[model samples]
Structures are given as structure tokens and as C-alpha cells.
Target: MNTPPSKDALREFLASKFAEAVEQNPDAVVLYAAERAPDPKRYVKRPTVQEVAFKRELEKMRDDQADKAAPESATSVSPAIRTNQLSLDDYPGLVLPGKHNEF
Candidate 1:
């Protein structure tokens, strides 16, 4: 990997190290990250416009679908959508042989 430390992160690290060094030995000169500035030319490449737009469009579509679904979930019933429920006696061998002992 060509990942070198960023300048701010490296500076923070050195500053902490410098503090630790002085706490341990006051006369010690532990210099680091003096010229280790982060290079924009070596920065990680950003996502392309098409990729960002596609992600945004997909998210918007999903949000619109969720919004469309939310209105149909009301508890009010108009007797048009029929629902049927069955007991265990309706289906034979649906329960395991061991599980049938408890029921």
C-alpha cells in the first residue's frame, strides 16, 4: 500500500510523542514530522459524478417506494382484502415428531 500518514495526523502523533519524550527526559530532542506535509497529488481519488448520482438516485427511488408503502399500512379494513388463518390441525406433519410431544 502506498498509504503514508496525513500531515495533520502525523503532526498530532509527533506532538504527542514530543510531549511523552519531554515528560520522560526534559533535555531530549525528538524532532519528527517537520516537513512531512500531506501531498494533494498523492491523495486518494474521489468518487466519480456518475457513481455519486447513481447512489443518490437509487436512494431517492427507495425512499419514494417506502413513502408509497407507508400509506397502505393503515389498520382500517374495507372488507376487500380477505385474510385466512389456519390451525395446526389443518396441516398434518407440519410439526416435528419431538415438538408434537410438547403441543
Candidate 2:
């Protein structure tokens, strides 16, 4: 069996595919797809000193929003894995027909 692609490899493959699709079908209405963000240095104009300060303050304001273990973006990148904590309480009708009416 073929091994699964690593996350980075999958992302690169997707980015390339999207680029191709856009090239072939610029008029296509894409519903959902992940495209790599363009390089800020190449695309974005250099910010003024005042704009830089404003950006920093905006980031600080976003960080101040109500108590949370981490930013919402943090969990989305790599979600935590949790196991189901099943217990007898989950099945009140299950019984082996022994002690206390159950074995």
C-alpha cells in the first residue's frame, strides 16, 4: 500500500493544483480550496512607520479578546486528539445477568 502524504506535501500538491485550475478556468467559481498566501514582501507595499505601529496595536487588541487557552487559529492548524471515555453509565440496559442483577 502507498504511504500517506505528509501534511506539507499534501498542501504543496493542493497549491499547485489550484494554480493550475485558476490558469485553465479563471471564470470557475471556486467554492472551497486552500491557496497558499502570496508573499507579503513581493505583493504588499512597504508600510509607513505609523502604519507599522498601527498594525502592532491592532494585533494587541485582537490578543486581548476574552480568556482562551490559545488563539482559535492555533487549534485549527493542528487539532488535539481525544479518546472517548466510555463508561457503564453509557449503557444502562446492558447486563450479564449475575450479581446485583448483572454479571
Candidate 3:
């Protein structure tokens, strides 16, 4: 009666077998591995011209809506006026006689 190999022995045997197979026909093993690999092309779908055009149109519509929602007077502002209402007494360091008497 034959006894089964231990897990370590089995793993080593399998690794040696795989290495031997890889050495024998490298291209075939590569192709086989590639076949088993997850296909990025399978998940890829081409976007139609209409779909691209529609997305562009939607973006343009959003920009137009933003422009329309803005206030009409957004750029409008009155110019600053020059005034002579200020006096020499309003300026700093102008000494007034009765000003410190109140403090």
C-alpha cells in the first residue's frame, strides 16, 4: 500500500512540475496563462458618436443655464465720487481746546 505525500511534498512536486513545463514550451504556457487572464477588452465598449455629441450638448446647456441664472447687473457698478465734505478738524493731530476737558 502507498501512503499519500505530505502537503509540503505535494506543493514542492507541483512547483517542480510547473517549472519543468514552463521550461519545455514557454510560448504555449504564456498563451495558456493569457487565455485564463481577465480580458480588459471584454469590459470595454466603444462610445457612439451620438453619445459623445449628446454629452457635449449637455455640458453646453449647463453653461448656458449658469449664464442665464447670473444677475443681469453682475458687471455693472457706479464710479466713486469725489467729495469736499471733510474738514481739517476731521484729520488726526488737529488739536481742539475743549476736546480733552470732556475726558
Candidate closest to the true structure, highest TM-score: 1
lDDT top scorer: 1
After aligning candidate 3 to the native by TM-score, how far in Å is the CA of 41 from where it should be?
A: 4.2
* lDDT score, candidate 2: 0.73
lDDT of 3 by residue, 1-103 (tens): 9999999999999999999988997875633334566656656677899999999999999999889867544744322212446555456676666665654
Q: Model 3: how far is 5 from its true place, Å?
A: 54
Segments in model 3 whose C-alpha atoms lie over 4 Å from true places: 1-41, 72-103
Off by over 4 Å in 1: 1-42, 76-81, 84-103
TM-score of every model? 0.35, 0.27, 0.31
Tell me how many clashing residue pairs each candidate has.
0, 0, 0
Q: Write the per-residue lDDT of candidate 1 for residues 30-99, one digit (tens) a residue.
A: 5676787766676677999999999999999999999987867765543344345555555666985666
In order, candidate lDDTs are 0.79, 0.73, 0.73
lDDT, residue 96, model 1: 55
**Arrange candidates by TM-score, highest first: which order?**
1, 3, 2
